[model samples]
Target: MSFKALIVDKDDEGKTSAGVQTIDESRLPEGDVTVAVEYSTVNYKDGLCLGSGGGLVKTYPHVPGIDFAGTVEASDDPRYTPGDKVVLTGWRVGEIWWGGYAQKARVKADWLVPLPDGLTTRDAMAVGTAGFTAMLAVMALEDHGLKPGDGPVLVTGAAGGVGSVATAILAHLGHEVAAVTGRPETADYLTGLGASRIVAREEINETVKRPLEAETWAGCVDAVGGAMLARVLGQMKYGASVAAVGLAGGAGLPATVVPFLLRGVNLLGIDSVMRPHDDRLRAWGRIARDLPMDKLADMIQPATLADLPELGRAILKGGVRGRVVVDVNA
Candidate 1:
């Protein structure tokens, strides 16, 4: 059988291009199960893989969707049978292997998780890797003793995917959410997602001379690293933790560790990729229960496989808002 996919290929001239291509099932890489992909999503990593590899792509003719939801078309593994709904993220499937930006995907059974009972394939893709990572960040903060009444939780990059989901989930859990965004235009949108206050990016993006500032946030889910994260550290309430999720601002941390040493602040690093199967199951189950479907609906902007190239560029430029759910078969 044959299917259509968005393929990113590099030419001998060293330029790369992405477009739709027809491919045969025989071309799929080794795996225990074959999935009829229903939906995929564009992430910051997808933006990199779609353009110049971002050092994440190890081979050419790659399909760059890092997260996907689908139904099993065929399977040799006893754990999954044909027609089983599944979701996949991480394990470097999109970067080093053929991924879900296609009508079909073949992957190891271990890389697949049964779609949680409350989520459809489209719903699963709507959550994607971004939302999954947000859930993990929230879980980490909660495990470290964060509670709704403790103090306001800050969400940096509040209009983006991870931040948007984090804001919604935290607010749903009864925490007061303070959203930080560079785009003033997204203030209403962020508030609609449950943020009680909007903090301008300028308000917190720079480094301060004082190593320890006034303690503010009870907890934080930081998607913008670099200086923003450094500054946020100084504002965390005593013994509070900030879950570090992304480096949208930059990778370097140019601040002192005064908050950690003097105030007992904690910076938790979140990695969705290579997460254990048990953790994956736990996160997805929590997402199904905690993340409201209505709010998820508000955060989504729909797309198809053909829109990926432009969306990829948009994400790289930080122009995309919320989650972009890609219908692979659309």
Candidate 2:
């Protein structure tokens, strides 16, 4: 069968272009399962893959959605069968393989997870890789003894995909959420997502003046790395942990170990890609139960395959708000 897809290709000179194209099923890579993709999502990585490759896309003429939700249309694996709802995230599928930016995707059964009961395919895409990573970060914090009454939890990049979901989930879990955003216009939006206070990005975007500053945040889910993460590390309350989810600001860690030594601060690195199957299932299960459906609905801004080019650039520039659910069949 022929299907529609956002095909990203690079020319001989290495210039890249992305546009909607009709793709044949025969062009799909090897896999045991073929999914009729319902929904995909835009992430920072998608922005990269859609544009210059960000070193994530190795092959040209690629389809660049990192996460997708769909129903199995065909399968050789005993783990999944036709008509089963499933979700795919991580394992570098979009970067290295033809991904869910198409109406269909064929992937290894190991990369698929049964869609948790409460989440529809669209809802799963609403969570996507970004929200899935946020959930993993939250789980890490909880495993490290974080609790609602412990104190305020900070979410950097609060208007972006991961941060927005993190803010909502943290708030719903009864924690005081302090959301940090550079966009002043998103303060109301962040608050609506359950942030108790909006911390301006300027307040924490700089490098740490002192290795040990005020013991502010009880815990944090940091999407902005580099200096902001360095600063947050210093400000974490004694024995508190910060789950490092992304490097939106920059990758370098200009930090000191004083927070670790003096306050016993923990910097937990979260890797969403290549996560174990059991853990993926656990996180998705937790998301269905903990993340509020209404709030997830509020975060959604729907798009189609045709909107990808602009939305891709928007996400990389941090201009895209909340989750962008892309209907592959739209």
Candidate 3:
């Protein structure tokens, strides 16, 4: 059998190009299960893999989708059988191994999770790795004692995938959500996602001389690290927590300990990749129970496998909003 895939290859000059191509079943990577992939979504890492490899994709002619949802076509593992619905994320699948930018994917059974009861394969990809990570962040915050009505919860980079999902989840949970975005045009969009306030990127993105400020926010899900994180540290209310998710702004944290020491503010690092199976199940279950389906639907922008190359570049440039669900078979 053969399937269509977005195959990325590098030339002798080391430049990379990606396009949809027909792939034989014999070419599938070694794995315990074979999935007929229904949907995949573009993430920042996918952008890198689609373009220049981003130091993540090591092999040429690689498939580059970090997350996917589908039905099992075959399985050697006892935990999954043919016709089982499954989802794959993390474990560096797209980065170090062949991934799900195709009509089919073969992967280790350990990396696959049964799709949560309420989410369709399309909905699973709509949440993708970005939204999954966002769910992890929210869980981390809650585990660290964050609660609704403590004060306003902040979501930085609110228009991006992680931030968008975080904002919606926080709002649905009864928190007053303050969404931060550089694009003023997205204010209405954020509001529709239930954000009570829109904070301009300029309002909290820069480094501040003061280590502690008004202590405004009760909790934060910060996607933009670097200076924005540092500034947010000072603004968090005493005893508050911040789940550090992405470093889209930058990797460096130019911060002080005043917020941690004096205010007892906590900084919780969230890592969705390589999470334990039980933890993955917990987060996905929470997502199905807590995250509103309508909000997730609103976040979706549909695409096909042929649309990936352009969408991949757009995500890297921070030009994509909400979620982009790719129908691999379309």
TM-score of each: 0.99, 0.98, 0.99
State the lDDT of candidate 3 residue by residue for 206-263, as single tens digits: 8979898997999999999999999999999989999999999999999999999999
Candidate 1 ranges with C-alpha deviation above 4 Å: none
Regions more than 4 Å wrong, model 2: none
lDDT per residue (tens digit) for residues 147-235 in model 1: 88999999999999999999999999999999999999999999999999999999999999988889899999999999999999999
lDDT of 1 at 150: 100
How does each model score on lDDT?
Answer: 0.94, 0.94, 0.93
Model 2, 119-165: lDDT tens digits are 99999999999899999999999999999999999999889899999
Cα deviation of 274 in candidate 1 (Å)? 0.4
Error of 3 at 84 (Å): 0.7
RMSD of 1: 0.7
